[model samples]
Each structure stands twice: as C-alpha cells, then as structure tokens.
Target chain A: MTPSTDSPPRIYTAALAIIGNEILSGRTQDANLNHLAKTLNGWGVEMREARVVPDIESEIVAAINALRARYDYVFTTGGIGPTHDDITADSIAKAFGLPLVEHPAAIALLEHYYPPGELTVVRRRMARVPEGADLIENPISKAPGFKIENVFVLAGVPSIMRAQLQGARAFIAGGRSVLSRTVSVLVGESKIAELLETAQGQFPDVDMGSYPFFKRNALGTALVLRGREEARLEAAYDVLVGALSAAGIEGHPGELPD
Target chain B: MTPSTDSPPRIYTAALAIIGNEILSGRTQDANLNHLAKTLNGWGVEMREARVVPDIESEIVAAINALRARYDYVFTTGGIGPTHDDITADSIAKAFGLPLVEHPAAIALLEHYYPPGELTVVRRRMARVPEGADLIENPISKAPGFKIENVFVLAGVPSIMRAQLQGARAFIAGGRSVLSRTVSVLVGESKIAELLETAQGQFPDVDMGSYPFFKRNALGTALVLRGREEARLEAAYDVLVGALSAAGIEGHPGELPD
Candidate 1:
C-alpha cells in the first residue's frame, strides 16, 4: 500500500533466503535474518519474508525464484564460499537460467588481495558469478558478492554479509519507514484482548500487537502500535492508554522495567 | 536420507509454521524456530523446513496444509491468544476442513483458572478448538493449546510455547537422534576447503559444514560433522582433524574460545 507523502511513498518488499545446512541442522544460529531485517527497516524497505533452505541446488533455486518473483528484492545469504557445500552462487545462476562465469573484476580483486601463487583453484571459485550480474563489493573479503537482477547473493558469515549489505544499500529504493510505540500493562492479554481489538478497530491502518510476558512472578502484556504515521500512532497510543486506565490497569510507556 | 544402522534409522521430518506479523515486521525476534529445531533434534526428528506467515487466514491455511503434507509433523506457534489478531485456530480448522467448535475440556480448564465473572466473552474465545483435536496442556496458563492431526498449535510467548511443547512430546513418535561434533580450526575455509571436501567424501553418511569466523584479528573456520551414527561422527571427526593437520592448521574440538 502507498503512503501519503510528497512522492506517494512506494512500498518496497524484500525477501531473504538463507542457504546452509548448519542453520537447518541446528548446528549454527543464523545471525543474518535479524540484522538484515533491522537494516532494511531502517532504510524504509520491508523484509516481508525469509526462507532457510539447505545447500541443495533444487531447494535454493525454488526459494530464490519464489521470493524474487513475489518481492521487490531477494537477498540470499551463505553458500558462496570456496567449499564444496558452497553452492549458492551456482544455484542462483540456475534459478535465473544463466551461465555461471568467472567475472574478470572478481578474479582481479582476488588476485590483488591474495599473493600471486597463493590464489589456488578452490579460492578462485569465489570469483564465479552469474552472467550479466553486478558485483556487490565485499571490503572485508576480496571475493565479491554478486547481484543478478532482483537477487543479491551474500556471504554466509555475518560480518562479511553485513559488509556486502552496506554496498547493497545503494541499489535499493526505499519508502516511508514504519514507526512504532510500546505500552506495557500489568495484566494478562486475555484480560485486555477486547480493549486491544477495539483500539485496533478504531485505528484501522495501524497494527497493534499484544505480547504477554512473565517476569518476577508477575504477568504482563506489551501492547505495540506500529504504522508509518507518527500522529496516528500517538493517537492510537492515547486510546490504548485510556482503555487500560478504564480497565484498572497502569500502562507504562516502552518496555516494562526489568 | 536413510542412515546406516542395524535396522536403518527412520528419519522423521517436521516443519514449523510461525504465524505472526511481529516476526515479519522486525518488531519481534522469533524465539520459537531455534528452540523447536533444537527440541526436534533431541527427539530424533529433523526439523526440515520453517515458514513465517502473517495473521492472515489464507496464508496460515496454505502454510499449514503445505508443511503438514510435506513433513511428518507441523508445529504452529503464535496467534492462539484470545485477541482479534489470534486467528490460528480458525485458520487451522479451515485448512483441515473441520468445524471450529468450543471444546468442553478447554472451556472447563478456562473456567477453573479464572475467577467467577472474570471469564468474559473475549476470554472465553480461548476455549474454541478444531473438531476432534486433542488439547495441549499449558501449565503456566489455563487456556489450553490444541493439536489437530499433525499440527500442534502453541502460544507465541516463549515460556508458554515451551511449556506446551513438553505436553506435545507425548504425541510424537521420534526416530534415532542425530549426533554431531564441532572441530574449530585456525585457518580460512578456502585454505582447507579441499581438505574438508575430501573428509566429507570419505564419510559419506556424515554431513560436514565449514563455517568461517573472524576473532581476535585472526580468521578461522569451524568444521561441524553430523550423523545418525556416533561411530560415523567420530570417524569423520578424526578425518577432519587429520586434514587440518596435513594443511598445517591446528584443529580444536568444540567451539573456539572467545
């Protein structure tokens, strides 16, 4: 949906495809999704969906195709290393039905970074890119991430992936950033579910969520209101606060004190 | 994939469907997927895939149907609360072509938990369940989660979801647990990519992953070996250790000290 602004803020949705067996196998915790979600949100682009697929070529291709078609941009993390399990690059190429080629720039960068004789055949595999793709510079590692059309292939490592994302910012055209406010109530969600529903119904455009928490032998719910319009958010917050007061509950702004 | 055992170990697969907008909007970090994956692994069941959909009914139904058909079991977290946004039960019922009915057991539990006159119309909504579904006990809260066929609908809150999972374990018929060993090394993945590949090839049953990390101004990779057979895992570990030694890299068991 378009936001009311001088430029009718275009809604851009992006999907993330995480490629690795480690993540799926519960061996490694994926640190990329949260970081990428926060980063994209800051840039006014919504990270709509995320899929974690194994290193299988068919799975990667399917995930890439589905996400890229639905969202404005599709970012893939992992499977781009020089190891045998590193199949993301080829899988992405296969998704687009394009030939995987060794880009001259990528090869030169790898050559410049590593000593002449040190650049082995396995290391050179990192230079392979899909045909007609642009390089997303990885300053930390010389082996650059590539962008083929709407798909961006990033490194699996968190630090390298984040570094590549910095360069990726230039390519994305974001819109109005979503803003939010939280109010914590010392009551159960069921006790205030009707109140929240009423508030939500009143502010049709804003999204209100009630998250219950248990702390220090006390139960409470954190009511969060999120939307693009700050004025509307403030209005909705006031309504929620008023509703809680009427229900004999004290509403605290932001998170409840630990 | 069948593992080599006295009687081939049955590989039971599961999928998790996270139903919430907070996760997709970056407002909440999903604590369910990791916990569920780890728990399933312990039960000798593999968590094959995970999908996070919004509060939308159609999305929930689609995810539920797809995951349930593909995997042996499907666990859905979030959207079971007594709020307007909590439409998981209805969506699940719609998916299975079952009528949404008020379960007698769920109503009794809620009635016993809440004081007289406290159980309002909104609070009573929690009693609704799919026809012929078994109630999942919630120790922390009175409102019970329900298991419809292969899908176990649990609360979104971490503590409650975990509590419900304890009860769900009784319903699942788990297979042989998968085992793993992590070998940390003081060399880049590219430096030992071929070595790891060779080790992986040697132990065909063991799945090996090389995850590179940068710590204390040094880059290294963590080689994780996983298999159903403990003997196979041990054999793969020795092979990986030998490979690292051959490449003049020191390999350490478990994770590298920070």
Candidate 2:
C-alpha cells in the first residue's frame, strides 16, 4: 500500500469489518465498532471505514483484501467461535496464503482455559490459529485471537471482543492522545456562529467542532464545542459558555452538557 | 460505473458516510449507520460500506465519489444541522457539481417549525438545499433532507434522522430484503456443530449464523438464520429448531426459546 504523502499529522486510519448475520438482522446490536471507534479516536487513530458482512468465506476474504491495503490496520469481529460456521480463521489463512495450524501460544491459552480432561468437542477448535501468526490474548475468554498482516481477527461477542481489543491496543502504532472538552448551551447553534468561527481560527492547530443536540423538554439547542488543545479547548469552551450567557442560555463545562 | 460482470441480484447495495466530528470526538455515539443498516436489511437492501468522516469538504467529496461509484447508493448522515459546521448540504452539492440554492420545499418546512422571527439565523441556513434535489421531510425539525443521484443526506441526531429516513425509505430500489430467524438455546455455541452444518447444507441460498449472547449472566447461543426466500428462511428456521431440540437444547419459534 502506498503511504500517505501529505502530512499535518495524518490520522492513523483503520477499517472495522463486522462479520455476522446476527448484527444485520438486529438480533445483536453490535457494540464492537463503537467501542473500537471511541478507543481508537481517543488514541488519535482515525476509524476511517466500517462494514458488516454475513458469515461467508468469499465475502470475508474479499473484504479483508479490499480494506487491509487501504487502512493502517484492519480489525474483524465475529466468526472466531468454535461453531461450524466460524470460518474466520480459515478465511484469514486463505487470504494470507498461510497454513491453518494450531499456533503453540493459542493451544496453550485454550488448554489453560479448558484442560484435556475438561475439554468439550466444540472447544477443541478454539486452539487452532493460522501458522506464523502471534496469539492475541483474550482476557475475557481464553480463546485467543490471532493476527495476519494488518488484519486482527476477533470474536463477535462484544464482551470478549472488547477484552481482546484491550490486550491488543498497545500494539497499535502511530497513535497520539487527543484531549477533548465540550461547552453546551441552550442557545441555538446558528446564534453562536461567530463565536464558533472565532474559536476555530484561534485554535488552527486543534481540530474544533460544534455539535448541537436537541432541546431538552422545551429548553433549546445545546451546542457542544470539541477540540484537541487543552488550554485552547478550555479557552474556546469558556468563550462558548460566555456567548451562551450573553444569549440568556445557561450552560456549564461538561463532556456532554445537557 | 461498470455494472458487476456477475449477475445483479434482487438485493440493493448502499454505502454510508457519517460526516460528523461529534461522533469522532466520542461526544455523540452514532446511531445513524446502525439504524440505516437494520432498516435497509429489512427492506432487503444490503449496506455495503460505511465511513465516519469529519465535516471536511475534500474528505466528504472523496468518500462520496468513491462509494457512489462502487455501490448502488450512498447515504450520508450529519453536517445538515443548523450550525455553521453543518456542511453536508454544501458538500453534497459540491460533490455532484450541483449549485447550492435555497430550496422552496425546505423553506416551507423550516418556516412552519419556527416562529417567523424566532430562529431566522437557524432557519435561513436550513433553507439552503441544493438545486434539483428532492426534499426528505423532517417531521421532527422541519429541516428537509435532500437526495442527489443515489446519495441521500440526512441529519445526525437519531430521532430527527429516523423521521427523515421514514420519508426516504421508498426511494431505495433494486435492493433485496434480508430475512432472518433465530433459535436460541441454553447451551453455548461450541456444542452446536452438527446442527449448524445441517442448517448450512439445507439452506444453501440463505446465510445461516450462530450468535451466542449472555442473557442474565447465563451462557446461551442464538442460531440465527438469514435468507432472501421466505420458504427457505422458514425451512431453515425449522431445521435449526429441530437440530437444537435433538441436541438436547430446546429451540422454539418467535425469537429464541427461553
């Protein structure tokens, strides 16, 4: 993949591919993407793309190939379970031309979780990992995750997936923390246009945004200010609060002031 | 754009671009893509791709150009609010070489929502919809959304965006509705291999999947069956339920068997 040429501190982008028919069917309100998005964004990595595909081998391979070449990292959720339809491991192996073998690290983790005497037939598949890949520790369940190239295959279940992500977070490179602050007001967003514009200019290095939430009950629109700069974030935040005060709209500094 | 050399199925495909800094900053968890995903799935149209881009003109345009050319439709959320940061209308117009103009239908809706002099600043900006685009009525805010080519641009907030989506649902064409059924069992997903294998063979056209979720701290798995054919869906669902029962795990109709 060609590297990004221009730079103003480029965002480290990743694409999330959620492979499950359940999420699309509305049976499982998938929270993995949202969780990953917030986590990656906080680390200053940009979640550029997200897609959900059914549990099809061809589909999975296609999506992995298509997305991995573009983004810095490609994370997949679902279909790593011990069930018959859990074909993500095989698909990843095929995509990377790697042999489907039990990695020593994964077998150890799986064995630690479910010993030979206590092992169920279904639990045996959890030990298999693609050859030449490192095991991604599953803090919640010992069914370890694995990586191939830029793709990190994970479980579909939110709880386990989040745990796997936490273990894998430190491995992600090119991340810088972006501190955020918010200033919400009852004043309509358009009423504070000049204030927001001034704030943006004042903090050119910081990426500033104004988000207006709906009026609570019969109050008014709440315009929340956000940016990366701490002092400027607070300063712009103060200016926004003062603008709301001038407009007779009461507000306070909060992450999400209602 | 060249049509897929392969056969075009009854299913419709779309890509979603969520243009918002609110979502990126973790200030607002985006519900638009998920809502649209479920809605589109119900309608039989597949949501192929989704991206959460900041309200930047070049980024928005590039995403729209890439996705619109690849998928059947592109739906963008956010950047249509009353705030100066709401750049969706202007961006969409610029993307398609369409001129930005005050849309009459939108102006009428905005005028009805606010008293004449109350929100002139807000309503005035909302009135500026691109020329040659149709209005997507907003029952919540009276700020009508716009549709250009295959791109449908809507609001960021869940409630208002949902309202606009209801108005625009009919406009989607050539997409297939996704039919899914589930059989939940008290047993974990690992034990359901034979049943899952049988379910897959019986329902070749339909995509069958198993999702295990913890309800009240109990380990239970849902054998979700999804397909386009009603008869296939019913047949597969029945097979799944029977397989579960035979495996000593109970399965019943109408959601998962408790």
Query: What fraction of the genuine interface contacts, i.e. the true contacts, does candidate 1 reproduce?
Result: 0.60
Task: State which candidate has the highest lDDT.
Answer: 1
> What residue pairs clash in candidate 2, if any at all?
B11-B176, B12-B175, B12-B176, B43-B177, B44-B176, B44-B177
Tens digits of lDDT, candidate 1, B156-254: 888889999988889999988889899888888898889888898899888888898887788888888888888778988987898788778898889
lDDT of candidate 1 at residue B238, scale 0 to 100: 87
- Once fitted onto the true fold, the runs of candidate 2 whose alpha carbons sit more than 4 angstroms away are A1-13, A41-48, A57-59, A62-67, A94-97, A115-124, A173-175, A243-249, A255-258, B1-9, B41-44, B117-123, B173-176, B254-258
Error of 1 at A26 (Å): 1.8
**Sliding window of 10 residues with minimal summed lDDT for model 2 chain A:** A1-10
lDDT of 2 by residue, B1-258 (tens): 223354746667887888886665555667777788888787767876666677789879887888899888788888886666788888888888889998877777767667677656655787776788988876665657788889998878788789988878778775557777766777777778666877798677777677777886788877777766677688777777777777777774555533
Question: What is the C-alpha lDDT profile of model 1 across A1-258, one tens digit per residue?
Answer: 335445645788888888888877777777888888889989998877787787789989988898888999999999888999899989999999999999889989988988879989999899998999999987665657889999989998888899999978888898878898999988888888988999999998788988888876799888989888888888999999999999898998998866
Give a tens-digit lDDT track for model 2, residues A1-258. 223243546558888888876655556666787788788877677776676776778888888888899899999999888888888888888888788987777666666766467566567677676788778877776667877778888888778888888778767885555666655556566767666666677666556566666545543454554444466667766766676677676775554434
Highest TM-score: which candidate?
1
Every candidate's DockQ is 0.68, 0.39
Where model 1 places Cα greater than 4 Å from the true spot, the runs are A1-8, A139-143, B1-7, B139-141
Q: What is the fraction of true interface contacts found in candidate 2? A: 0.41
